[model samples]
Target: MEREILLLGNPQLYEISEDVKKEELEDLRPVFEDMFDCIKGIRRDYGFGRAIAAPQIGIKKRLICILTDKPYVIINPTLEFIGDEMMELMDDCMSFPKLLVRVHRYRHCILRYTDENWEKQEMRMDDDMSELIQHEYDHLDGILATMRAIDNKSFVMKKYANPSLSK
Candidate 1:
């Protein structure tokens, strides 16, 4: 199932997603499959992508698929900011692949979520992992990276921000 990722201006992208019910955990396999495939497509065409959220694929569920050395399915995640420290960086999204937004994100966080078997799990994330999780977590709450932009000057065309993207 190749699902089209909802674009930035889509109204549905603004709607908050619903939490996945414990009983529905078994049914998320295909959704995870589609999300993993979606991120692969994004990487193949756009050159960079690490994860995808259910909302990006119009699933309206609190789920995120992280595709790195291995795949991780985050279900109904909650984040606890570790401190006041923040880092500003250019963030991109599958919803608006060609755009980049300069935003500040917490440098560390405690991510708590339910795994595939519905067991509670937690991870202390920092650096890139922290930013990546925050990005996808925003999607579940009807938020986009653009909404977190530092200022009007925070937005830029991706090609200009990343020289490699110009290729």
Candidate 2:
């Protein structure tokens, strides 16, 4: 299934996701697979997308699949360590589809998640990769980088000023 990329300025982009169960993960796998294929198809056309969320694909679930290719499937994901030591990065989202915004993010993150095998694990992310993880995780919660910009009073450039930001 070639899932169309959800663009920025879409109201569905801000709809928070629901928690997922172990069984739901099984049901969502095909969707996730299609999303991966879609993202892969877009990769060369688009640029870097280390991660993407279910909401970004127009499904509101607490689900995200990250391709560290070590890959991770996080259900009911959340962010912590939102403190001063964090880095303020300029980021864009596949869900937002476009619009780059300078937003604050943790320099490092300890993510506790359930892998594809239904095993529970915790992993850490730092630097640009950390930013990528946080960006996608926010999508799981239906929050876009632009919303972060609105909260942080950061500026969001109009679309395709950074074309790579598009889904």
Candidate 3:
């Protein structure tokens, strides 16, 4: 099958991705390039996109690429939610563009992961950063924002959300 964006109905998106080994990093360089291109293209076409998980592109590997001021490459990432605080917001995904799902995420979190250079890295995130990383982390475990909707009425089209987030 062609390795392209896996949409909402793609079974591959629901499968739990495997952890990528450090030894595999070099070989996955091409995959990284494709992921950057994919996320950038989506952001360009849809007006919003911060990151993309490997499963979104039909690759069942625990990897995510965040394109902000610079690129953030997270491999085998794990999240640690801080405190008992939660923030509710509308979440969007590359897998299902323009379909927003309202969900609750931790207000603060610590993300630990392997970087592109194979170095250990951690980021203490709050607000938008926390929400963005949490959204991508969920994709590693076969979870989607749609599955975490607060209620049946939490779904909305991109244009309908009064104040859309860059999720």
Candidate 4:
């Protein structure tokens, strides 16, 4: 089932997500399925959405579905390392597609997460993947990119923020 991505005012988006237990991972197939469906739906509508956290769909679980060259699931993700280098970029979320927030994110990081089978895995990611994972991880911690905005001037409507980009 395709789940609705909770909007900015939705309380579920602000609630801290619970970590999924190893035993319960298998039972969460439906939630994972729905997350992937939600991401697909968002991309279809917005033309750009690489990942989505469980909380965005009101699941309140520490899970994120990412689509790159292929689809993958990350359960109970943790940032194992953050590089000293930082980069500023306009970040958008599925919850607020019309808004873009300028935020700073690590240029590189090491992330550890569990797969669908509960096996532990770690990967080193460069700026793009690191930023994407950080954004999704913040969602798991009840943190929105809007909250991480560099300043008052950092937030802007997507249309006004990037005129060159298609709506």
User: Which has the greatest lDDT?
Assistant: 1
How does residue 11 of candidate 4 score in lDDT? 81
Model 4 alpha-carbon miss at residue 79, Å:
0.2
Every candidate's CA RMSD: 2.1, 3.5, 4.0, 2.7
Where is model 1 more than 4 Å wrong at Cα?
160-167
Q: Whole-model lDDT, candidate 2?
A: 0.72
Give each model a TM-score: 0.94, 0.82, 0.92, 0.92
lDDT string for model 4 (1-167, tens) is 89878999888888999999988977899988888888888776766788999999888899999988888899999995564899999999999998999999999999899999888999998889999999999999999999999999998875533344564
Each model's C-alpha lDDT? 0.92, 0.72, 0.88, 0.89
For candidate 3, which ten residues in a row score worst on lDDT? 158-167
Instruction: Write down the worst ten-residue block by lDDT for model 1.
Output: 158-167
Candidate 3: segments with Cα more than 4 A from true spot:
1-3, 160-167
Q: Candidate 1 lDDT, tens digit per residue, 1-167? A: 77899999999898999999998887888899999999988887788899999989889999999999899999999999998999999999999999989999999999999988888999999989999999999999999999999999999885533456565
Local accuracy of candidate 3 as per-residue lDDT tens digits, 1-167: 22468889888888999999989999988888888988767766677788889999878999999989899899999999899999999999888887999999999999999999999999999999999999998999999999999999999886523245344
